[model samples]
Structure formats: C-alpha cells, structure tokens
Target: MPVVTTPPFTISSHETPTGLLRVSLSGEFDMSVGDALSRALVDAARRPGVTRVIVDLEHTRLIDSHAVAGLVAGYEAAAAVGRGFTVVNGGGLVQQVLDVTGLSEVLCEQP
Candidate 1:
C-alpha cells in the first residue's frame, strides 16, 4: 500500500467592518476544493451585514476549469443578493486563466 499526498488547499477568511468578507486562497485551486470555495462564498455572502466578498489569490499557483466555474458560481451567488464579489492578487497561471476566460475585470481585480 502507498500513502497519497495532495497539494496544499486552504482557505482563510475575515470580515471587514464595512460588511465585506475577505477570503484568501492558496495552493491548487482545483476541483477538489471547488465545492468548498462555492460554499464558503455563499456562506459569507449570506452572512448578516455582508454586502461584499473579496478573494485574495496571492499564493495560488495552479487552477482549472472547475475552479473557474466555482468562482463564477460564487460571483453569481453574491450578485443575486446585491453583494459584490471580486478576486485580487491574480498573478502567474491563475491570472492567465482569468484573463483568457474574459473574467479578469468582471470577476477579478488584478493586483
């Protein structure tokens, strides 16, 4: 038998005084964590006095379509409730995907 190890996948968050939930995501933003991402966003958006969701991707190095989809889902969820959602620190491969998919400005604010 062999032990399998996965890449780092973590999510850290905080709430701002102005009704914003700021989330930081690092490691591989792939399918494995996609659902978690969506759920987290939805939870944050649905929080009392929460009018915005911001995700920081300063340490994210890899991503896939599933991740993109999750992010879009989060954005949609936020927008439906009059809440704002944006991604920042999008650099490297992550930035490329966001840009190529035409979601750079719509869903993200590059740093």
Candidate 2:
C-alpha cells in the first residue's frame, strides 16, 4: 500500500494603522496556488492607504518558478505605486532558491 499527501498553501492578511498590509503565507507555493496569491496581493496593493506590504513566508514549505514569477510581478506592481514590499522569514531552501534565481535582491527582505 502507498500513501499520498497533498501540498499545503494558504494566504491570510491584515492591515496596520500605519497603512502597512501584512500577508502571511504558508505551505507550498506552486502553479496550483500562484494565481490565488497573485490575486490577493493585487487586491491588497490596490487598497487605499496601503503604503507598504509584507509577505511573511516563514512557514512556506516550497515555492516553484511560477510562484517566484508571481512574487516578482507583485513586487513590481507595489513598487510602481511607490509602496514598500518585502518578504520575510525565508531561510534554508527557500532562501537558496531566491538567491540562485537572483530574486533575493529584487524582493525586499526583513532584517
């Protein structure tokens, strides 16, 4: 007998009084979940008084190229509006992928 497992991916968000929106993303980031995330980010960025956006990926299990592209696109869109965008709590494999793809520099990272 064999067992199959499903990848986990979810996005939750909230806003701060300072107009910074924080979105916490968990689980695998693949083509299956890219569009959902893209839509969420786009909507958040378009909201009034959203001067900054932070994507917390501390619990993210995996991220594929499609997800990476989505992130880049989201970052660019936020930048176009003069809004701050950042990715935080990514380490280990996730960090490596971002570094190899040269997206680490393009996307802001928390200290």
Candidate 3:
C-alpha cells in the first residue's frame, strides 16, 4: 500500500529496529479518521512479533477529540492483548492535544 493514505488521513506502518510496530500518521485527524485509526491500530497490534506499538505523529497536521479518543481506544486494544502502545514523534497540534488532555506524559513522551 501507499505510504500516504487517500482519505481520512495518511497511515503508514513498519517494524522498528527494536521489533516494535511503528505507525506513522499524517494529514487531518478528525472524527472521520477515528474509526480508521482504530482499525489500523488493531491490525498493527496483532502483527506477529509486534510486542509494542508506537504511533508516530510528527507529520500529523491536525486532530480532533474523536481522533484522540481513537488513540485511547487503540491503546486499550493493544493493552488488552499485552501489547504495549504509545504515541510518539508529536509536535505542533499533535503535541498540544496530547498535552491538553494530560496524555503527553501518559500516551506520549516525545520532546
């Protein structure tokens, strides 16, 4: 699949050197993208050897509460299966959301 998705938002995934599933998100993150984000995370978390999942949001330009909710849902789904989940590489609006919601230190720890 293409690295940048066509609708909702762009999503790309790969295995990190540390064997973690790294999902990169870009473009607009809103109510429309919420369900898609959850589905993507679910797929990533279930991959073999994917003991951990990292959502890299460095390129994400915008986000809404529903998108954040999807992130939380993704976290919960990963946790349920003993798979670790974290949002990373956040900046700008992405970082702001994580901070405003007090998830900066919880879901993300990027500087």
Please report how far candidate 3 places residue 90 from its true position, in Å.
Answer: 1.0
Tell me which of candidates 1 and 3 scores higher on lDDT.
Answer: 3
Alpha-carbon TM-score of each model against the true structure? 0.87, 0.87, 0.86
Clashes per model (N, Cα, C within 3 A): 0, 0, 0
lDDT of 1 by residue, 1-111 (tens): 011124577777888788878887778978887787677766766677888889888988887898888788888888888999998999888999999999897987645
lDDT of 3 at 7: 68
Per-residue lDDT over 1-111 for candidate 2, one digit per residue giving the tens place of the 0 to 100 score: 011124577788888899989888788889987887777776667678999888888988788888887788778779888998888877788888888998888785635
Q: What are the lDDT figures for the candidates, one per model? A: 0.80, 0.79, 0.82
Instruction: Give the backbone clash total of model 1.
Output: 0
State, as a TM-score between 0 and 1, how close model 2 is to the true structure: 0.87
Higher lDDT: candidate 1 or 2? 1
- 1-111: candidate 3 lDDT, tens digit per residue: 136587657999889667688899988889877788778877787777789998989889988898888788878888888998998888887788888998777788555
Q: Show the colliding residue pairs in model 2.
A: none
Off by over 4 Å in 1: 1-7
In model 1, what lDDT does residue 12 have?
76
